[model samples]
Target: MDSGQISIGQIRRSEHLPARIAAQLAAQITEGHLKPGERLPTEHSLSKTLGVSRSVVREAIAQLRNEGLVETRQGVGAFVSEKCARPIRIKDEELGDPQSFRALFQLRVPLEIEAAGLAALHHTAEDLARIDEALAGMTGAEKWTHQGVEADLLFHRAVAEATQNEYFAMFVGFIAERISHAIDAARARAVLEEIVEVTIAEHVVLRDAIASRDPKRARQAMRTHLLGAASRINLSLEEF
Candidate 1:
């Protein structure tokens, strides 16, 4: 086996050992390197292999079990659970992490860009009006407030609605709820502390792109606005 396969290197001394161990095992399981129901390496073997204590390995296995990623039977040690074959949900505790925020933002980029293009082709007068309402809500509200964040979410949600596809709207609505906290945090960041005017101006740019029914330009406008947003939030997404 490759040396990299056997270890996650030395965990930081102050880090949560159990969660770190669980994260490694969970990744292997999810990636199919550890197939569903396959027996996990014994606690003793894992402790030695990863250069951690047996107690740390044991606790990590317990954490995985709670997460539906693994199961343990008496005297048989842990095995990847059948649930590992399904899409796994991350714990609420992990949602606040920067990596998690980047993941959600990554998922948002394509959906939003495509939706903007579709909106240009299909949006109704009512859809345009709703989007403008959301924009006005943002422009009129105090910067960095929850109201501003809600308006921002509404602006995206309105674009999703304008796509004339129910599924697009539904999925974007789901994502908005999941990342509401991050939106709040991003809005309050000092780097974005004075970005209110810029934010509203960009929304106008997007609304006009769609209003003019230019699909290509709409997509580019949406992408540029969102990329700017990611920068304002200090989100480091190498793939973006």
Candidate 2:
């Protein structure tokens, strides 16, 4: 692509613009449009060409650096890494689409299963109460409602928090927020009543297992709930 064709396009307020921009440039590197050791455009020039701020351009470059997609010298700008590229993260919006439901759940399963096991091993009385509060929020809410969705996210986050690992809490919070729309899309495709009912039962089982301090049961319960969610979304594991 030429400099003339470099616009990054209109960005949504809620989306992380720098991450989107970084993903775009990384694709260029992976696809060979940007050759290894070739200097990137100056941040100021990128800001002008992409119609984003200089800070956004800088952050995009920084993200690529962190991902090992690019390298920088103190006086020089960025260059594509000489090493073969790893698979880039699918953009959150893309992953959260109903069509990508299986992929989404596949990403969730391992992390959340470990989170559940740790929560079972580590949860205190207050942590248990927080989990129950989130459950109560869902119980009082109707299916497909915003309140219910938020409650559901909180339940997962509470479990992460119960693990007593700050990184787990942060990562779970990010995943929960990103997956909300996908979860809604899944519900839209299926029987909302059945989705709600089954979700409640699954959450209760997982929560009870955690509260009982059964790591094995907590892991199994979480796995069952996520797999069941994929089914509710009409996704087969084979799709992943």
lDDT of the candidates, in the order given: 0.76, 0.77
**Best lDDT among the predictions, by candidate number:** 2
Query: Ten consecutive residues with minimal summed lDDT in candidate 1?
Result: 83-92
> For residues 80-199, what per-residue lDDT tens digits would candidate 1 score against the true structure?
789624444564467777787789888888988899999999999999999999988898845457668768877888898899997687667556645656665666665564677677
Native-to-model Cα distance after best TM-score fit, residue 27 in candidate 1, in Å: 26
What's the count of clashing pairs in each model shown?
0, 0
lDDT of 1 at 170: 62
| Total clashes in model 2, counting residue pairs 3 or more apart in sequence or in different chains | 0
Tell me the tens digit of each residue's lDDT in model 2 across 1-240: 345555356556566666678778877777777878877888877877777888778766765764567778888778777866432445665774656745556777788999999999999999999999999988884545856876898899899999999668756655565566667776777778888888989999999999999999999999899888777766676423
Stretches of candidate 1 off by over 4 Å are 1-91, 141-144, 191-193
For each candidate in turn, the TM-score is 0.59, 0.60
